[model samples]
Target chain A: MLNIKNLHVKLEDEDKQILKGVDLTVPAGEVHAIMGPNGSGKSTLSYVLSGRDGYEVTEGEASLYDHDLLDMEPEERAAAGLFLAFQYPVEIPGVGNLTFLRTAVNAQRKARGEDELSSGEFLKVVREKAKTLQIDADMLKRPVNVGFSGGEKKRNEILQMAMLEPKMCILDETDSGLDVDAMRLVAEGVNALRSPERSFLVITHYQRLLDHIKPDVVHIMSNGRIIKTGGPELALEVEKNGYGDLLAEVG
Target chain B: MADTAVLASKAPVAEKPRSVLDARLEALDLPRGGFTAAARADAADRLNAMGLPGKRDEYWRYTDPAAFNAPTAEPLAFTSRASTLFDEIEQLKLVFVDGRFDADASDALDGEGLEISTLAAADAAGDHWAADLYGKLETAGQNPVKRPFAVLNTLAATDGVLIRVTGKVSRPVHILYRREAQDADVTIHHVIRLEEGSELTLLETGGIAARSNVAIEVEVNKEARFHHIASKRADDAKVGIGHVFARVGEGALFKSFTLSVNGSMMRNEGVIEIVGDDAVAHIAAAVLGDGTEGRFHHDDTVFITHAAERCESRQVFKKVLKNGADGIFQGKILVKPGAQKTDGYQISQGLLLDEGSQFLAKPELEIYADDVKCSHGSTTGALDETAMFYLRSRGVPKEQAVVLLVLSFLADALEEIEDDRLRDDILTRLDEWLTSRASA
Candidate 1:
């Protein structure tokens, strides 16, 4: 469902390269986790795939569902079924969370040549989806992430993911700043969306998130490239021994 | 009427001026006759002393007062026919034609707890309640900067209205201006008084004249409430200057908001004084000056005084400028000595769409009471880039996203409106304006 070959990305304002010669692939219907140490280009990978500004793809190519992801704008990418749950969800003052969600949902639907949802229909769906994540009515009424707690913001991201139902999902450090109970709730929400036609690229530095929503395959990312590949047990090994043994062995 | 028309047809062309300030004022014609001798002399003297604010004046530095201070202007035949707002509900409609009350087109003035009459009618009635309020508030509000045009309006206003409310008014009052001739200079003055525990809402719409000067004097007595919402728009050739002088009594509430969409030149001034303890006042404006042929200039000058203990006041102004348009905001909050526990807030912000457009803001706060809470802030910037990206990433197109951000920036000022229906009407017009702007 997602493919990247020798993806080289650099800071748009400087010569520093964040993602250097990275190659990875995730087939349809599989959950793939990329475990990496600090500053190992984890978040950078997510940003590049999501078409964020201030990043230059110096070399290589990335595609989703065989579409030229690198050629599309960020909104076009979202319309093409790519979702990125940010590590730090944006706080947009004055734009109600419900208003933001309805606008996004309708905009994507229009771009996809689908009928827009009426207010009544949209409100019903949002409320139902929000119920599973414990996002109360008042939370949906407030501005987007304006006064949200850390866990609430992560869960709000998950709620958006459920609403959009993208084909390829990227969760960048979703487990950070989340307590054990909050992490489990987020994992449950993610696990409920698993389907035969969907895929997930879970980028995390810890294995606790994988405990609730197990991944089909695990890859060890170092210095902007995937250097090791293994099964779910690989995540446990990294959790127990950390990245020191793997980095030393690779050297 | 025939004689007036003959005089209008035979009007002499205003000669080239050796001095802009000297050649004006005495030439103006008051259609409804003049005010009391002393009152007119006082107003005219105050105006002559200040002259017309020049570009060199500190308060008028950002905006040139040349258009407002022009020596002579020919009448213009306005052709645009725009619909008036707040027509969806029941209202008492008062129409004015070039600053003269059109009694034939106005509604009957009969309502419970309210006494409304035209300025001409009130003047003809001989001594009345309006005599006490006619220019009292205007005279009391001229402390820091004297508004020469407002004083001129007080002296020369042809016809307006005097409204007094003794109890809750069920319906809003609408003042409609229908312009037929261009280059016409109109001076209008209105006086409103609210007795103890009374309430009122006043709505104003339309372009009054090509060159217009309006003065609104309001008094909110103990436990009274008042709301003023005005939306003014005009083409590139029009110039309008308006002022509001309001005094709030003990435990009274007064709120006023204005939406200025398009004009060649518009300067709106608001001066509010809270004299009674526990009174509250809020004055806000959302202005936009966007035009195609030439720059649209808008200025909002507000002064709010807190003189009583535990009184609260707020002043908010937000402006959006584009296509070389210019916007100016000058506001101050004063907390008088012994006015302890006074709370005041002032914020002025501007969003410039292009480098050619400019925004000048002067926000000030003077506090003499040690236990007061006061804060003032001013910012001039482009749209928030990060917020723009976030909205665009969510699939809202660039234009729609910008509109969202702009509307969000103005939400606070819009919230000052007390009536939901009136607020929604203004909001719909604003939305249409933004949509057309996006296409243009």
Candidate 2:
């Protein structure tokens, strides 16, 4: 349910282009993995879709369901059932993890014209979601991502995704800092959220993450565009040979 | 009291200069007759010599004292619906309206191992212990700064409280100041003494005068403990000028925290002396100024002296300013020559929410003992962009995210409060302030 048509993006301050006439779509109930080499505008696609600032969408039509995603603010996009698990989840001191999540959940609920959750209700739901992601109560009590290990941050992000239950989920290289065990736990958490009503766009630089989650569709993205589209066997081929032959074929 | 020409000439009690402060002094109704006569006369002579702090004064460089030097401060009224702070806590309450003590509304003046009396009620008690400690700390606290306003309060204050504690106080002594008079240019003075091995917690809120000057003198005796918390509740039209002079005795503890929000012009000054060996003192404040009602200016000036050996002291101040509001902090830690093995720390930080807001800070550490460890720091900046974005991307609106970041910046200062419940109470008011003032 995530669609981008003729997408073109540029740096806000400079004229340098990032995403040049790329087209991609992730249909409902499907998990699509976009494996790319470094500096292939993979991260830019995720950022632009999430409505981050400091990016000029030169020409694009990005939409989620019936909403014009590009015209909405970041929070509005989140309320419209969009979630982005960051590549590097930044540490924010002073805001306790529980309070941060509660504010986020309530803001989204309010934006969607839903009644807010009581404190007790919020604590219960968060504890359940956190347990699945191996996030203990102490982790929920501390400041958001402050003093957390890379694995803990990724788990925290998954906990957020579970709590929000967004329809269109975009995992932006969440496996970068995570170790083997952490990546499996993260994948399990992400895999749990997969339903017929939910879709995923997992942007990864390696095929190791897709091994645990097992994407339904694998797209070879190189030089700002998806050069090849195939099934799960394609991820195994790239893991065996890397992007060398794929880039050569695209060139 | 003014019979001797030599005494008046040396520190001319009547030969005052023509200035805005001099005019304000004329309007003040100084405590008259009986118990206050001698102290009031001496304070007048000192104030007459010093005059009021002018706009040109180095200490008032960032904040123009001229706003408070008029014949009478501008009257302000707060019509907000938020309830008063500390209303839920069980404590003894003393009410004052328009600087006059409201005896009918106050609690009974009887407690275990403690004695409490009004300054007016204690006028006839010649041997009262308060008489010995009254104005002593204020006079002793004046060192590097010429505190003319405190002196002016000593000479002009009409009514106040005198408290003495000898054992641990079960409940806090809350002074509830409610304003009933508009244009009430009231001056007040309070005297508190904690004897050896005693403990007391004092809570104060509201009743900051429309155009008010307040002075509190405290003495924590050997091995005694004293805690003071004051919240100058948000009243945009109010001018709250206050001073606290305290002395911590041997092996004693003196801790005070203040929360100031939305005052049009507020200047809070504190002078503390660690006079006894191994004494500990901490002073902290959280000031928030969102210039919604106009230019909100808050100034906190503190001077802490380490006169005894092995004593420890800390000064923590945090400010959140927006909409062109001004925040000023001047803190100094002084360690004497024999005050060896002293440990002291001071930090003042400001978070300016918008481009128009301003924060000015001056931190000083004067150490004479080579063996002591002391440091001071001051910084001013806006909220962290990464932190702001992270909060917003999580679906928190920009306004709520800003408040969250601002409060996160102020957590350290709030953590300095020794009591957990009191800190939470203040946090409630802090959130209310953000919702009401910072939303714009």
Candidate 3:
């Protein structure tokens, strides 16, 4: 459901090229894991797709379900069914978590020409969804991500994903700061949302997260381009041998 | 009034350079008759000594006193607000039209554990309890710093209310001001006393007139409680200056909060003295100024003194400005020699929505006691970019995101309101203003 071809991007304020002619695609109902070392542009790909600022796409194109993703604003992209789970969730001091969730949900609904949920209906659905993610009433009442533990923030992100129900989900290092149990909970949340009409693109540096989510395909990226593509077992190979051997083999 | 102004200008005092103070007093009309005649005369003498505030004055450095010192208020097109604060709550309502008490619109001045009288009526009587307290606290407040406008208000205020509380008042007293004349200039003074072991809440709202000067002198006696909530309504061309001078006795509690929306110029000053041990006092304000609608300038100045041991005082002020709006804050906390264990906190913050807007703040603390804990902080900044991106990424529109951030910035000042319903009402108004302007 997501496609990218020759995506070349660079820092908008400086003369450094980040992503050099990267190309990849993930089809519907499948989870793809992108494994890469530092400065490989794994995170930059997600940011470019999500329409973040401070990055200029000099060449190439990215699309979601035939819709031009880079042509829309951040909020417009979300209404078009693209979600990015951030590695670090922001702490908004006075905006209550539940209030934020409701606003986001209603805003998207309005943009899509759908009837917005009333407060009562929203509370019921949110409570049910939050129960699965183990987010308590207090967390919902508190300000967004303020004073939240590391695991709680990750789970909160997953909760937002469930609520939004995007067509394409991109997890940018969701497992970076999570413990073993927290990682399992997050993976379970992701696995539950898997459907034939939905797709997943997971960018991570470790196979620990792949152990629970079980990706359908694995891609080894180095120097801003995907160099190797294979089955899920490819992740295990990289885990055992490391990227040093893969770069040498490619050379 | 013009004739009166002319007559006052030709007074016996020597004419020296026709200074701003002299020119201002020349244009002002002093009250001719009142039960406060003696107090008015005394205040007039003091006012002449101090003179009208000049831009050169230390306290007036950040804000110009030219508008306030002008004799005639500039005319404005009056537009009634859609709703009034405290509309849902049942209470005693006192209405004033351009500074004159509307007896027909006001409720009967009789209630449980309370005594209320109009200053005009009290002036006709020979003796009254208010005569003893009227302008007393204000006279005491004019020390270490000069507040010539408040002194001028005492001598010029023609009508107001005098309230006395002997026990817990069942319902709050609501004072609602309304303006009809476009160029109305009004001066109003109120004196309130809470006797020992008594409690009372006072609510005020509306922009009294095109130009207004108001003063409320409050005395919270031993073991008493006094709560006040007021608002300066959005009037694009309104200029208002208000003051509250209060004295807290042993174990008493005093709290005051104000919400100010768009105005041409507004200056609210508070002078509080905690006299008895263990008393508590708090003063806070949340201001929203948007110069795109009109010329917006707001200033909040406060001075609090701790004279007794173990007393606590707090000053919190927050402002949000955009489109070239200007905001100023000057606050100070002073602890006396024997006032050990005094706890005082002060914070003033401004969130400027655009580069054109500006905020100026001065926070000071002086402690004669070695064992006091007094801290003050001031900051001015724009909205957090990372936080803005976070909100926008979640499908919240840019305008809605801005409204959320502005409200968040003002939450600290709103938290000072003790009543949930009142606080919520103020929050609703703030939200409505931000949403409408953001979309505009």
Positional deviation of residue B15's Cα in model 1 after best superposition, in angstroms: 18
Per-residue lDDT, model 1, residue B292, is: 68
DockQ of each: 0.63, 0.64, 0.70
Best candidate per lDDT, number?
3
User: In model 2, which regions exceed 4 Å deviation?
Assistant: B1-21, B80-83, B124-126, B436-438
By summed lDDT, the worst window of 10 consecutive residues in model 2 chain B runs over B10-19
At residue A84, give the lDDT of candidate 3.
91
Clashing pairs in 1: B75-B182, B75-B183, B76-B181, B76-B182, B76-B183, B77-B182
Q: How much is B377 displaced in model 1, in angstroms?
A: 1.1
- RMSD of model 1 against the true structure: 5.7
Give interface RMSD, per candidate: 1.5, 1.2, 1.0
User: Model 3: which residue pairs collide?
Assistant: none
**Model 3, C-alpha of B139: deviation from truth (Å):** 1.5
Each prediction's total of clashing residue pairs, residues at least 3 apart in sequence or on different chains, is 6, 2, 0
- Per-residue lDDT of model 2, residues A70-157, tens digit only: 9998888899999999988977776789988999999999989999999999998998889888899999999989999999999999
For each candidate, what TM-score against the reference?
Answer: 0.93, 0.93, 0.94
